[model samples]
Target: MEKLAGMLKRSREDWAYCARDIMGVKLDSEQEKILLSVQHEKMTSVTSGTARGKDFVTAVSSLCFLYTTPRFKNGDLISNTKVALTAPTDRQVKDIMMPEIARIHRRMVSKGFGFMAGELQSYGIKTGHEEWFLTGFKADEHNHEAWSGFHAVNTMFAVTEASGVAETIYDAIEGNLQGNSRILLVFNFNRTTGYAAKSQSSSRWKKFRLNSMNAPNVLEKKTVIPGQVDYEWVNDKVSTWCTLIQESDFNEGEGDFRWEGSCYRPNDLFRIKVLGLGPKESADTLIPRYWIELANQRWQEFVKEGFPRHDVLRLGVDVAGMGRDSSCFCPRYADFVDTLKMVHSGGKANHTEIAGITKVTLNTHADKYTGKKAMAFVDTIGEGAAIVPILAEQGMTNVYSCKFSEAATDSGGNPLTDLTGQYEFANLRAYLFWAVRDWLDPSKGSKAMLPPDDDLLQEATEARWKFQSNGKIIIEPKDDIKKRLGRSPDRFDALANTFYPSSQEAVAQDLSGVFF
Candidate 1:
């Protein structure tokens, strides 16, 4: 028994031994690579296909780090040997990782391994000490500060589902890695442009890629050899994927697997979910991804350089009717645009709460940019018309009601025409969207800026446009966009309303003045 205990203690330093011996966990070849990379590299990133044991790898790596590290005399954790885990949501950290850690710890204890008396709590592990033995955090973009102020000698910081975590949170975790600390980032290869995909080119990170086919159970009968057992647990995973692909009519050819039911096409979804590749932009997108990227860059620069205090601010509101869609408000100062608020009322918000919040946003911006005038353009469709009168009651007299079906007019009260002048847009909504396109066009020499919001970017890119038989440009109906996206493009609509050409004088004014 003494010899067995000593051997188990030594195995803590070897993750594979500890997992297989103490916890009775078995890892395949790719999972072994992930564990070894965590031990040997200062930074490791793994992008893998679905059901490739990512969570299992994370749990084993975390336990190995925790059990092997040195402890202090008072039983308090030595700052040098702490383990921190983070995910995009608290539920992931608490429900998923914590349970796995607790299960392994319980198994080890039952097998007579000398793990200290500890109970795994929701977001942490609690031993006899008042302070938590282990901690987990939600790496929200707005809450980067919460991830900071941690330093340790041989720390292990693990980010699960890292592709969904914000870049700012990653930056915060990077700063916290000190001394001989290491970081492990694991996620599905869901996006082509985020930090996870970009990390492959970075020399500092040791990267790993695994696919569903890598699992031993997914192999054909001929692939299995004597003494090497197949992973029967993954048979359902293989069967479901095969069935989904076979049933999909969109499959280009035989042996070509496609998931037709996904929001993205089969090829794109397959690349992201099964083949462990970054997502490729679809060819049919309306707004180019580059435009949104450039806009985000310009917005970041504007924030760093300081918002022009002298610039007049414009506000745009897209109201929700009796629906699940949100009421979105966007405020623009010069080239920079900020979504002031997105209120999800479940179609239950009272008039007073909505009106009060709108009034507060206007007053706050008005106070910030003293001596500058303010204008508001509001969507008057459905329940939105109620807000116009409410704003007027609040002494915001510069508000304009915008009806999508109304005829658009130029400053001279004539029918508004596009740059080509051959034909006008079908309605005011189409005209506003074209104006937004022109404003975002790099060739137009407009450095228009937009917030780094994923929903806004999706709305801007996915909303399509068409030319009417009469030669007028017509944007796709909002209902169609809502059906495809699973939500209304309220953010994009609010932004477009801000660029409505109500008066030529307003457009010509250099709102930035000396501040520019």
Candidate 2:
């Protein structure tokens, strides 16, 4: 009790004391840094990999922010101070964060600490004064009103799972930050945008990324901490969950990147969920800026510098008539794209005429390189379907009608995955775009040299993708893309169609049973 009195003055400035003495927790190095950062900085952002004890520390700091406050004039009890602990969902606050806080409050009360007194309830601790309290609730994307009325003078805002909280809610929280107020955000670091992303990315906030790779246990390859991130677990996740782009998978017609693998999905999830780096930061995107800029630089160098035109192996046609969308023809060499043709018919050409134009365009594109019509892919989903039989009648035997809505296929003409595979495609649209993304990867020895077309770059980079509930990568529908960009992604679509990721055998299998 005497030791507790001596610590009162230091408690206001020292969160480690409050954590160790009052809460009975010995924070790790990362947690200690977080606690001290919250002590001095107005805004502290914590983006963590799996099992880093950030939530535990966040709960501890929130509780400490409440208990360490100086008392009112009438008593040695706090008043007119508030700490708000919020998450994207009520269950998270009620089940995970608030419970930890309640347990700690109960421990402090049981230990006979005389300086602070508050009623410890379910998810709140309130002082005798009506205004003094610590509370937590759901502050999801839609709940702008939830952050309102939290205008306390010595306020502390702590958000858990903050990635799910929307920008409007963050703005509301920002508006309420006044004198002696601070905000702490702790989250899984999943998203690449939104206020949570800004908190990590923007220099305004002091940020910490608690990667599992750097965890003490993971580094030591042992259980240094009983429940912290471990080395073997990380190895398991890397082998089972993450994948690098392998060009031979498409070139050899052996594999398709079906989001998830037979069981292990080797993609960017490992970067966010395990490595804890900011990642290539491609969440919510089809192609990351990292890869897009790579292709752009290639265009400025090899293609823009007037490289020799080689034999064109593939030609892609995205057909649209007098509608808002333009008919785009993308010609891709073995490694780059230099020539492109776009026709905006201005409501003058029908699908039949467009088909005739397509056949002429294909012949022209081929004449530049192979002097014969190359194996071509035409978007035969809508009005473009009329162009298929018209071309077949024109003796265009090399063209394959592309049904964007058809089921995705691998190098071989299978459903999507064999029995051993786990991931599924949303449609052929996603599969083709994914192939374009793979083809444009800078790491590949033969990355695509693209024409530096602005619309192509915008559509290629801005197209969004997300995983379905079953954990399959799904591209945003073209209609949604049009809504966001205010025009159809015709050039990008044509560019995407250039990557028909199938070998000769796969094509033969598709032609045997599939429609032209």
TM-score of every model versus the real structure: 0.48, 0.51
Tens digit per residue, CA lDDT, model 2, 236-311? 7766775545544442111123323332333557757875544554467777644654566677788446687676
Error of 2 at 137 (Å): 0.8
Off by over 4 Å in 2: 74-79, 114-117, 140-145, 243-266, 282-516
Candidate 1, residue 37: how far the Cα is off, in Å? 16
Per-residue lDDT tens digits of candidate 1, residues 172-258? 878878776778888887775567765643446887777664556556533342223244533433344444432334322122333
For each candidate, the alpha-carbon lDDT, in order, equals 0.70, 0.72
Candidate with top lDDT is 2
Q: Mark the regions of model 1 whose C-alpha exceeds 4 Å error after superposition.
A: 1-284, 367-370, 411-413, 418-423, 504-516
lDDT, candidate 2, at 129: 70
